[model samples]
Target: MTDEHAPATPATPAVPATPAELVRRFADRLADLGLTEAQAATRAGMSIAYLRRVLDLGCDFDRPALLRLAAVLGLEYQELVSGRPEERLHAAAPDADSAPLVGPPLLGELTVPECWTRLGPGGLGRLARTGPDGPVVRPVGYLVHDRTILYRTNPDGALAPDANREAAFEVDRTDPKLHEGWSVLMTGALEYVTDLALLAELPQPPAHGRWVRLTPGTVTGRTIRTASAR
Candidate 1:
């Protein structure tokens, strides 16, 4: 009798980027199509928990999962497999209106609800606060929960225990070609969320265990676009 072994699996078309980046791109694209994570997961034939696990670094996913994700998101499988930057996710209709602005571009206010919608649930944003050295700003990974901004930081980090201090958190999206984008600014006092029960209940990046909440005193935003752009 001859010894037999299974044939080697084919290698991935390209080196896979960090799962978080791939997942974020997927999520953002789906969001542009007005779909939520749960909806997308269901359509992709995967549990939300499994999707979240894939988004968390160190988790494993096979090519079948990748195929399902690409098909559900309407992405090209080859582009995804090769991690092509030119095929980066963008607004579903990148050039919906190509007409010139009737007047001039102007900054317009975005209502609180609009701001929250644009902020979504995940991504990086800037957190600005007053420090001993005056004002400081740092990039932070954040999630929106119950109209409040939440992020995790080391217990000893400067931003971790700022319980009564007012701070500003901002997130934005832009299109260089269109010269248009929107920004949301949230000003609030920081509050520590040390309750284990409460922490477990909130939606956040899986790798972050320590968290702080920003209870917004004011949620304001602005957008730069022509009236006809929409």
Candidate 2:
């Protein structure tokens, strides 16, 4: 007689051996995350057509594209490419004096000029302003122009600040492996950009939206160095 109370065995995922199989595996991962092809492509900063083409045609392995896709899928690059889970060893504590003692992290304040230097051709930053509900912080792509912070936002969006309202913007960079980083903060009056001439002078046109400028009243920065080379 067959047993009626046997536990169901979990199905094993198939190992991918070909380009087409790998793409299918990627699709499976997206499904697991409740994401669609378009969503995954968007998060990977690639076009939907490109994603679909890969899925259909099974192109050769592209490292850059695969890396971005792996990040979006929340999988390690090796794990995604090899169709196997990443193997990581638990780090063991080092014995006392096993290695040269790199003294405690050195913290230092940055000068005004140094702060500007650190902000160099900005990438992304946090914009803080008061919204209809309360204080709000949003991530925004920004650039340092004429010693002021320039960013784009929807005119009616929650991130858009009132005319000449006080706001704060911050940018930072860190390397987890190196245990070193720097952060710069700016407090200023935020206002909508009405100067078309100034906008034209920018290296590139801002995204289709209202351009905002933050004229900082005070700027401050700090840096932490854990390695001797810094």
Q: Show the lowest summed lDDT stretch of 10 residues, model 2.
A: 85-94
lDDT of 2 at 29: 72
Best candidate, TM-score-wise? Answer: 1
TM-score of 2: 0.52
- Summing lDDT over every window of 10 consecutive residues in candidate 1, give the lowest-scoring window: 1-10
lDDT of each: 0.65, 0.66
Clashing pairs in 2: none
Per-model TM-score versus the true fold: 0.57, 0.52
Error of 1 at 20 (Å): 15
Candidate 2, 30-84: lDDT as tens digits: 6544456776788788899877665554335456787788777666565565553
